[model samples]
Target: MQKPALDIHEIPSPGKWFLLSIQHLFAMFGSTVLVPFLTGLDPAIALITSGIGTLTFILITKGQMPSYLGSSFAFIAPIIAAKASGGPGAAMMGAFLAGLVYSIVAIIIKRLGSGWIMKLLPSVVVGPVIMVIGLGLAATAVNMAMNDADGKYSLTNFSVALVTLAITITFSIFGRGFFSIIPVLLGIIGGYAFAYTQGLVDFQKVIDAKWFAVPDFTIPFLTYTPGISWTIILLMVPVAVVTISEHIGHQIVLGNVINRDLFQKPGLHRSLLGDGVATMLASLLGGPPSVTYGENIGVLAITRAYSVYLFVGSAVMAIVFGFVGKISALISTIPTPVMGGVSILLFGIIASSGLRTMIDDKIDFGEKRNLVIASVILVLGIGGAVIHIGQSFQVEGMALSAIIGVLLNLVLPEAKKGE
Candidate 1:
């Protein structure tokens, strides 16, 4: 690994702290807010909880693993599912349960090495499930890009989406260095500006919103009481399996980047605890579940600034930004088409990531069993196949596909040792 500009434990000067931290804030800002915007959670609360979660993570990891926690795109579909089946309360409850799943896994990884988990959820299972997570949302992106307030198809909105997509693609493929990593942020801003000229953006909400006020929170007990719903549980808990795998993968990549074996030093269990506890905290406060942001990882890689102090400073700024009502209103006012435009690229990138994972690991489709595993997973997940356990609960889509993939991998025989 390269020598980082800032060491993980180094405390920068007060001036450097503010400047370096703000860079991370920009790095994580777009994707973090986008999650809650898609899921109907308050963006302000998401910011607040993510900041708090980052602090908690730093504490738990003993500042050995320097990463920023933010809203997870993986949970977007399931949160929408849980919320639809029950309500916002149910969504938060399902998220809490998912966080519990993380804690349980952390304990297991602590007791035993993570080898068993990798065996259970090999690339064959995880790859396609991740693809399902991304492709499943493809329609949502298109619909938002084309639909108006009344859900009617509008060519005008579609144009905005197209513009947004083009700019994002330009930055992603053509832009150099730090600019390339932040295409999502730049695309949204460009699209919003374009929409403003066309009379598509409505700034009345922003104008009316107070400069300083408490951002509205959708608290579990206070907003709505949560009930045990197998429907929500079945829909959500299986997704945690995928995310835990994601967490481990992130640890590996980050460890590679920082020239420190994060898993060994902080220990995966303690770091996982930080992520789990952060998720639980977010659900309690009506924020989406948190994950270590890949965007911020990119920022760290480019800047070579690995300082824990930078992360702390950034997290503090996020919490501060959350209370500023003007920020909340401004975020809310971003046009749906603009969101949709960026989302098209975002979701597709997710699906592409699964394929990239397979390619990176040399997953051989020439092997019939491997081919079968991947084939079944794609169809079941993307085809929206459902398996009903009872009247009230069912496993479907991504969750169902993930469970089936694991079972099939377990049952399938390996090739001859000679072969």
Candidate 2:
């Protein structure tokens, strides 16, 4: 489905472009930085790498797909697991392999066309996969909000988180026009102010930071202690399969918003390849993997500005900020509970989007097949079911749930509407 074409000129004025680009930057900043904060990677590196990745994506996709690439939440579990056993090097290896999987899939799509993706992961499968991505993180969000970083419950932090969350929701529901698209930023500010008032914020880091400094870059493969582990790589590679569904969904939504068939234009293979290569590059630099940012999509949906230049400008801005250590330090001072507050809302929106996908597609829950697929997926994903395979391998959470949903959808026969 497509809407009417945008008519505010192919390029906005320089001033407008800068303002819009800043909006895009803010839209993506929260999730991008959060990935590193959660995974213990350098937030500075993540920002720079994501900026570079977004630019690479644009160049490879021929500036056709107007999306920003930012840190992915999908790799949080896998990266954390790898870090536990083999540290950040192992996590980088895992993320690197995941990027390779995306590239491989892109190659396959280039040869085979995109129809098979639909047959394999229909709405019945994708809807639950998305839901799992959101629900699976619910506990983490709650924990961060209610408990201190050391796992001790803190009433102070919880109260701060509540304030942030309430303000975010209020803005999302009642704010109009462009402001409506920035609930995350508003929430963070509102929460930050409250935390600062309570003396939770430490401004020394920000004060000590230089206005401009080089990002601390690391090459994971070169610095790995015990070398790369094939097991870790293989374990993380399958994550791309889940993210591919999200990639497709994002393109569909963006296409709908801008009234353009982006998938048909640049083609999903190009988009996949671009994102894959971007993620690969980012991982090699010890930064979190990148994905199409939903926040930026919200910006696009409201502004109705699909110009590729806007994203380019935003990427450049992000890269500039990445070099400014002061900015990173300031963002870091946002406090855990404040982030937790925003995350609860952000994560819930992710789950709701999945529901919206199913609803918009008119997926019939009356069918036993649909019911079973969704039910099993929800339980396995949200209930924390893990499947062990052999002595050295296991699958659980979103990845496990996604694979199971796809298989079930493929095996089950579609019921006739009247039958």
Cα deviation of 403, candidate 2, in Å: 1.6
Worst 10 residues of 1 by lDDT: 215-224
Top candidate on lDDT is 1
lDDT tens per residue, model 2, 163-264: 999999998899888778778888889999999998899999999999998866668535655356555754577678778888988888887777768777
- lDDT agreement with native, every candidate: 0.90, 0.84
Compute the lDDT of residue 116 as modeled in candidate 2.
Answer: 88
TM-score, per-candidate, Cα-based: 0.98, 0.93
lDDT of 1 by residue, 15-90 (tens): 9899889888888898899999999999999999999999999999998888999999889988998888888889
Global CA lDDT computed for model 1: 0.90
**Any runs in candidate 1 off by more than 4 Å, and if so which?**
none
Q: How many collisions per candidate?
A: 0, 1
Root-mean-square deviation (CA) per prediction: 1.2, 2.3
